[model samples]
Target: QASLADLDILRRTRRMEYFRIVNWDNMLYPQYEDKMQKTIAPDIWKWLQSEAKRKLAEKPVAHPAVRAHWQSIVDGIVPFGYNVVEE
Candidate 1:
C-alpha cells in the first residue's frame, strides 16, 4: 500500500511531467497553422498565457479511487484498487 507521502511525491512528479510537456512557446505542427488561425489565432496566445498561469497556481486533485484507497489503507481496511491503463 502506498502511503500518503508516497502519493504526494507521485503527484509532484506527474505535475512536473505535465509542465514539461506543455512548456512549449510555440506549437510544433506548422501543418495546423491554417486551422489554428481560423479557429484560435486571435486569442490563442492570450488564452495559453492565462491557462499556464492558472494551471501553475492550481493544486493537483487526486482521483476519487486513489483518495479512497489511501483512506482505506490508513483505516486498515480493504483498500480500493485501481489500474493505470495507458493506451
Candidate 2:
C-alpha cells in the first residue's frame, strides 16, 4: 500500500478515512492473527468507496482536494506483485 502524505496534490485532500474489503474466504490475504480473520471482504470495501465518491460528487464544488492529488500521482504508482527476477 502507498501513502499520499508526501504528495503535493493530497495537500488539499480531506482527512477522511475509507475502507476496502478483501474476500479472504479463500485465504487470499496474508494470514493475519486469528483475531482478524473474516474481517476482510470486497463488498464492504466497494460500498464505502461508493459512498465517498457519491458524497464527493453530490457537492457541486471543487473535488475533495485530495482527488486531484491522487489523479496527479496515478502514473507514479508502481505495482509490487511478485514476479521472477532474472540475474
Candidate 3:
C-alpha cells in the first residue's frame, strides 16, 4: 500500500538524531557553508535546530519508553561532548 506516512523516514530519522545532539554549526558539517550575507536552502539543519529546541523545552521526564530512547541518544551523543541530565 502506498502512503505518505512511510515517506520521509530518512529525513525524519536523520533530523531526530541531529536534534538529540546540540552541535549545530558549520564548524561541524559543510552543510552550512554560507550565512549572514549569503545562504542556501537550510532544511535539514534548520529542522534540527528548531526541533531540538522545541522538544528539549518540554523537558520530557516521564514515560520509560521515551527515557530509554533518550538514553540511547545520550549515549550516542557522548562522543560529541554534550552531557545528558540524569536523575
Using TM-score as the measure, the top candidate is 2
Q: Per-residue lDDT tens digits of candidate 3, residues 1-87?
A: 343334456448655443222235655666554322122234543444454445555667657665554555443433134333321
Ranking, lDDT, top scorer first: 3, 2, 1
Q: Mind giving the per-residue lDDT tens digits that candidate 1 earns over 2-37?
A: 665665676787663221123233457776553333
Winner on lDDT (1 vs 3): 3
lDDT of prediction 1: 0.42
By TM-score, how accurate is candidate 3?
0.26
TM-score of decoy 2: 0.29
Shift in Å, residue 6, candidate 3: 6.0
CA RMSD of all predictions: 18.3, 14.5, 12.5
Question: What RMSD value applies to candidate 2?
Answer: 14.5
Model 1 weakest lDDT span, ten residues long: 78-87
Q: For candidate 3, which ten residues in a row score worst on lDDT?
A: 33-42
What is the Cα-based lDDT of residue 6 in candidate 1?
65
Pairs in steric clash, model 3: none
State the C-alpha lDDT per candidate.
Answer: 0.42, 0.43, 0.43
In candidate 2, stretches whose alpha carbon ends up further than 4 angstroms from where it belongs are 1-32, 37-39, 60-87
- TM-score for each prediction? 0.23, 0.29, 0.26
Give the local distance difference test score of model 2. Answer: 0.43
